[model samples]
Target: MPSMGCASAIAKIPVSKAGRKNHNRHFGHSEEILTKEEHISAMTIEHEQNTNIDDGEFDQIPQILFEGVSSLKTIGCPGTLIPVTNQTRAVICGADSNNVIAAASLLGRGRCLVFAHSGYPYMFINVDVEDRRFVENCRLWLAKGRNAQFVLIDDTQSLSDVPLDETILVWNGECIKNDTFMQNLHDYLRQGGALVCGATPWGWLQLNSGKILSDLPFFHFCDFIGIKLTENYSNCSNPMPFQLELIQFKNIHHATQKLVADPTDIESLCIVGGACKDLNVDVSGLPIDILKNIAMKAENEVIPSNSCPIQDKCCRQKSNGLCGILCVLTSTKAPGIANFPGDFSHPPVTETHVIFHIESNANEWYCTGYYAVAGIPIQIDVLECMGAMGWSIRIGCHSDHLEVCF
Candidate 1:
């Protein structure tokens, strides 16, 4: 059965005094340490609160095996098939049909099956026809057994109805249902199943809801994929034209590849991808490449960056007089600006002081004042560019002033 590549490591750590001390130190905590049993109990409580499922529900599910053990021959397909016995593992993803199909094909060799669903509830409600059809095809393929296992749980079925065992949950972004599913998912993993989750656009999942589910194993699960979902996606404001540049990342499981997507336009204001656990491998290769391609072919032109002049910097001194300082600065707030100036253009001004100015009408203004300065020598990259830069500068009584400056 395909085992959880990362969870095992978390479990092996001892919970004794030394282990607790190590964990506390590693996590930066000096609070009381819980014993192994205590930790499990806490996790159980947290899981239940998040998933809204009882221990009974999780225990009733059968164990799923992913690696090593093998059984049933085939699902009447060319790919290898293992018996859906108690130990048979399964990956349940809420991805588009293409990903479902591709992931299924790639994971078919494992002693597990892939269960893909059509677009999540949000997409089902808003996507256009072509997009809808694409999702339908995914559902159809799974239902027809073209892939491992295809199941659909729409508004008709309450999340509670879904059984949990050796199951993996994948969503385009994050899930907002509640703790019920999360609890059950935890139980399923404890019972032995790995969850391969990716939050595309990085923190895009959090946009669905302001809540953060980082406390759960979801954050830890991302390690296997090689990326860390950041709390910000502001870097995507001027999403590169699909064809002009394709952002690719490496993956531990697969080689790098282009991400294909509609080229006309992309949601520039959302999180895209972020830091990876493994820099050598790009896990976001497939989806990112696909999305990038789609955006390139898009009819809409790419948006510009919004530069702010609030600069921040960090400096480190090496052995000799040599020192490296990293500096970051957002351009003065401007209306209608989308993209941040490229780092190459605004290379750090060695020993130079950067200044930011802003002017805005009193009634149209958003804030009283905002200013930042950073002095550094290291190369810096403008995180994101939104659009025209503007700021309001209060000059005595005539404070209501608006000026457009980049």
Candidate 2:
């Protein structure tokens, strides 16, 4: 809910007690805490590297990189429906590199900075040397922007040991106990920082053993987790079938709800390119494409402008297969009319006392029938009528002095 500002400005804001309380409620005390020295060391290493190309030509870099840089802004994790600024960053740790990479790609296209762990691929796909290199390339691209930074964290360390003061923490994979690290992570997130995370299927099994899954501070720290603690089930699956999915928070309908209470604070974000199908197959033996389509539809349908009546009306008319009429009266005969493309068809024009009927159904009115206007008014019924036949219609009128075709 805070305005997009410099990272320094964000860091200056004091952590609220409520945030601390929330953190305590989720993650219990850990044995190994991250010393202040370690945190500093990590940040130092991250800062030392110049991820950007030394050549001043910004155009030399891949467009994806530029897009990623542009998208950098304060993003509410898991619930990153709206970007808060142009330099926000996401911190992903302990997850498979593949899922992180996929998510990073989506976020980057949206202009958000992504900081992910350099561990194993998060998905089931075999991540070879080339794949690993691509992941690193993404990091470099993200680093090029003044708004982005890619921090490669050591997997051996627990998430709790890492500093999460002003970052949106995405904790994925299995649990690594470090009470101090958890406390800091929780504190950072509870103070209005965003987080998105998911446990591995194996971790879910462990949780099923009466381990009090929801009791973990990180579980409650995030706005939404892939899995449900109380129910021990996940509404989503890994290797998501779609490039991006809109995560719905409790009682929030609009995507901008996470950014601000105002209706105008949100903007449309894009899902450029990434693997959309699930890496793991389901029991029905159906292709992952089905799930991918479902997710894509869910995400795309939530565009901020979708609430506008005019937009909805246009979409509705298209769905009903009705093209609006555009009438033009010309003095040219036949006029060597061009055929409508395959995407559209031309309607037939008959001269038998044609009656254009506008039928109203629900809240919309559409042309439903056309009557023949023949001499002496002979009624003719046509089974099918095509609307908007062509750019122009031909009319023939005969007079006593001259035969005119218009």
Candidate 3:
């Protein structure tokens, strides 16, 4: 029997921590103190409210994983300061004045809960009941509604040896140079198998070679998944620099951004392959000036075109008239329509690739990808235009199969 995907069940989570000496130096303490032990105040943010399932309402995966628990008392530890990628898809459940302590990420059909330092393991050195309970909650959240049988894959074994249908692969390796593994992984995702990737392909590519190769397997993988990995890296202790503002949801027949009150509801999938709108919700149309602004941003690479046969096909489905929205295409190359900007489908589907200029380290790093939203389903991409850079929130799905990346 096929088990759930990586974040759903079996997985390997990497934890990055700073050295003790650096930790002391960072806190402005004397080098003589071997260890600095102090309780930090962690504030919790409520991203979503629980819904009553019995009332026929769609229940959302609690964005705040640490429910009822306000804060955790821990010895001031040094861990990776994880930046928030997407607000709707992830929640900073716990955070001190300076850093994020705990969070939960909801992907396609899988869920993952993350903590700062050696979370559960740290309890052995100093026990905190809240930490223990939080760890327990993380366990339940990941393992909920599934069996727990796991398989370990090392250099001795091949991914082909394991049944793709029966496993969810968690790959945290530095780089995947193997051609066969990449091909198999692509097929697995198309078949609705999920994956949890610790590092981005650009992280590997930039370190190896400064240029991106279109023929590379990693390039194909990112194209297939509708994500663009940049050669940028986040600076030390910098919080997330961008915020996504939900634009107006308009014409299901032509718009790329789709909003769902509840992502888990299967009825939303009716608009999956087809762009016809069957729902009776009011259309908060996108502003014309905003559309022109987006076009102007991509003016260098975006060529204005009105010859979309797909839009014509979708317009025939309903009585709604043709939307006169202009279309833009990126110059990036891949195998298929993944790079084309259009109203594709739902969460985890990237409609078009956003272009970014490579600059010096004076600017912060931002990567673009698709993530399933909790309260509302949408996708986020980092775009720079008119000397301003921020997150561009839109909805699109190019994949026929449902899978998620972490």
Candidate 4:
């Protein structure tokens, strides 16, 4: 194993491109043949908005982080794992397996960025945290590579001390009711810094709207990010529980793969926020020419509005037994996203219209490009369930009741 001090040598470590031989081919086959105006450059991002770091020093990490025993979640999608680049070295593999729990990606100019799935609630005090590798790895990852000689943060250090650099930062955590944390994140995004929140950046926003209510009507964070909470799918049951079979995970989209170090079998993933798409970060933007020109004209239209008020407010169920603080990716605030209930824990829900379906489903519908939500695994074909067989279909962002029916 390479020592932390030898980051230069570690960056030079030879890694094999064992499994990613067909990325380009796959994208080519699935192309929608977008027009010139549709393809946004990653650098020319249009952000209507926005990190604070303190010490400006790197944290020193102990080798023990790579030595912990583990129990990994092969359950729902843990957010698509980024491709294990030929340059990636397993900083910490999970228990009894080679599944990388923490990894480092050495980019150009001797810059190194590490990703550790440990700062969140689930991984915080679990067995995976035996040596505090998880938390430290995240802090260390943000230290800005090359100059990052220290791998462990001091007792007084936190992400607050990690200086905010202009980069893509994903705040995938449980919940954030703190004002300081919110402000810190706010500052990061305000400077046109790319930030992806697939989890709990909306706790404060939701609280503003009312816990029992998911409207998330107004907030600068929501406006600047171009998104707002609409539902908490914990109550949206799959009605057809017995019929549904094995859990299925949606693969990380091609556009999002760059966000993670080695994007592979990743779950616990939610849709990318609209702000992320506008910023041209990791999210795969909507390809809705078909939906706009053809689908909408057909009467079965999916409009993108800011009014989706759900009456089946079953807030007790929770999504997959986890908090489902679902939010719409758009800034227009009405309520909910296209009448789609917040709860996917029950039946009648086909995970077909996942994050991938956002743009294709008609960006007008506030249904997705959701943030601060949990992943769901289900059976049943989407077309079959929606009863879209030879029927006029229109899906928009505003609604009062059933989203789409036969």
Candidate 5:
């Protein structure tokens, strides 16, 4: 639900042709409840209060939700405000004129050039980001749930004061205006310091479609940090970004009918599609398996696809420790529809969260892994509009790895 927390999470972004324009949409995710009743939707929502709960209420949520993330909640309704930028479609907004959340990014470095969404720091958590203070409960949750640490950098002046080796700067809306500070931060990154621009709702321009296009600025000080914004670019071609198209297998090698040559015949969730449909010979719904990367034999060339393919090519699974598929996404769309040879323990007792970050756009998707005991099926349900900044992921679960390119 975290990934698909937004109503528009699962549905694809509307993509249009030359003259026509497209719009935004929302998708929803549900939980799968296995019970004797046999006839009920999975998403179970038990709202104790109809009224909005304040910071004190956050602790009541289950511990599972904060597995790999920390959260912050604060009291007070000072509200947020910002000053509109001059000669540009930008504005500095927040709880006041000083607490600006958005900025315009000038020509610079790294990924897409545009406004940075200095909004919610982490997409996985739901909270009023205006109250930007790390909650003690959240800190404890991440440490206990994942053995991870969460440190809040309360000051930017400390940037130069501290050493920059493997440092990951999570910039909240606070603008880095001083040229000297920008240069110092940039140099630090060149030396291998990691940088991530947070999200904000400051630069929200009323679009022709009557929709608010919100993005934080990514230029000026952000340039040295490898974040820039492209001018005069305001249109979304693909709306349903997560709709997974099913790419069936076309051809299969006869060897696939038999298990791996090894005596153990280890189970593998092989990445088979295009021409490798033959390898998925488990129509009866038996366990699906593939050779691990280390188990791949020299003869395991490539299985030629039947009906060409999505990107058109032979299909092959790289057995790198593939307890699951490392969906290394290379396209704008993550593989929504995926097939895995189900060989995990019956009735997946553990619910693992797989988070993917889109490089082109700093968007993220939180995929929940569900294994149905009845069919031994593995389903990676991607929640709707969940995204944030960052590359490398901290994965915890019993499945193969998947990478997405968007």
Candidate 6:
């Protein structure tokens, strides 16, 4: 409803406002509220030697929000959506050895920044002087230039009233069951409206029936944005499934360069990766020898087993399938690889259409998709997923959209 900047725009995004009570109530002023000296001492010991925000561009503007912040002390936590640090659009702003403290990116026509922790207004109570300066700086930065108006849609009930302007729309990952709301979003994006749609497919699946990508209420929107949610969840211990690389998509999509950021921060941010049956075709019963041969014989190919380790699971599951080269294997007849060693009638499976794999992580979780349209399409990246907790997408365009993302 008001003009927004990068950092300020995030505050207006429709995230849960729970856990806003003062931390003093949870820790009791006597025990948890450290005196200035005590607080400084505790945080000093925790700084580089113990804190996770030690490395990388922590000095970046986003780190100001964490200044003087030793640890989170809150109650009735509403949880948070873990932003995917490795996607094409996301830029890791700050992180430590364990997690990403902050990330920023451009989507469609707006900017977005995400942090792993929560507790807003209350957390701002008794802020450090320097930290306060950081807030003021962000405000000043916005006033200086990025004073674009933004809209945060808390519910689909108000979709009909979404303002007609250049304002960027931020959708709170609420599932849209109504077609009118879906149509509104579709038209909005088509008309160059910016959007930040949050998603929590895995969390939705916990309370609902069926698979995440298909069952989640915001799925139609997910498809429109070329994002897919997987059942796999990542944490401090697990690693992200896909490598962080800005890709230059073929055809009408433009190429762009990699935004300089810490790969560790990027990897630490993605919390979900899992095999989704809907995103891949069944290549289970296909002969392993031919599949391996196809993977090898294809130009610029590597062994499928080595490249796609998930095939092992598919091998064991029998009913499930392997993707990538196998997807090509089922649909094409490679010169040397298509034929079995001897059986003349058994030309390895072939189809009328070739299934081209656009996403590099297709072997990992099959969570990204591509669709071609008549006009220039909105090229977006699936920044992160928090399973049932929800996910988010940023839409904006800059001059350097040609950055490659393989």
Give me the candidate number with maximum TM-score: 6
lDDT assessment of candidate 5:
0.27
Residue 9 accuracy (lDDT) in model 3:
13
Regions more than 4 Å wrong, model 2: 1-21, 25-130, 141-173, 183-198, 201-208, 220-254, 257-406
Could you list the CA RMSD of all candidates, in the order they appear?
A: 19.0, 23.9, 22.0, 20.9, 23.9, 21.3
The CA lDDT of each predicted structure is 0.25, 0.27, 0.30, 0.26, 0.27, 0.31
lDDT of 6 by residue, 1-406 (tens): 1111111111121112212221121111222233323432432332323222222432232333233333322212222232221221222211221122223322232233332222222223335553464334433322223433445565547466866464555555543445556566555544444444444444555555323344344543432232333343224222211112311110001110111122112211111111112223211222446444423443222112323332343232221122232332333333333222333344444322223222221112222222221112232332332222223332222222323311
Model 3: CA > 4 A from native: 1-144, 147-157, 163-168, 177-179, 186-194, 200-203, 210-219, 235-290, 293-406
At residue 141, candidate 2 shows an lDDT of 47
User: For candidate 2, what is the TM-score?
Assistant: 0.28
Angstrom error at residue 178, model 4: 12
lDDT of 1 by residue, 159-266 (tens): 356543322333432333333444444445444333322333223323433223243233332321112333322211111111101211112112111112321112
Better of 5 and 6 by TM-score: 6
Segments in model 5 whose C-alpha atoms lie over 4 Å from true places? 1-116, 122-154, 201-218, 221-406
* lDDT value for model 3: 0.30
TM-score of 3: 0.32
Error of 3 at 246 (Å): 12
Model 2 poorest 10 in a row by lDDT: 321-330
Q: How do the residues 1-406 of candidate 4 rate in per-residue lDDT, one tens digit apiece?
A: 1111211111111112212121111111222333323323211122101022211111122232322323223322121122122222233322211122233322221223322221332332232534364334433443432222221222212346654454444434333324445455444433433332333322433333212212221222332222222222111111112110111111123213432332211222222222122222223333333112211221111222225322332321211111111121221222223444444466442334332221122212232223222223222122222211111222232343336521
Query: Of 2 and 5, which scores higher on TM-score?
Result: 2
User: lDDT, candidate 2, residue 237?
Assistant: 36
How far does residue 300 in candidate 1 sit from its true spot (Å)?
A: 37
Model with the higher TM-score, candidate 3 or 4:
3
Regions of candidate 6 where Cα sits further than 4 Å from its true position: 1-145, 164-166, 210-212, 236-278, 281-294, 297-406
In candidate 2, residue 199 scores what lDDT? 40
**What C-alpha lDDT does candidate 1 achieve relative to the native structure?**
0.25
Residue 181 displacement (Å), model 6: 1.3
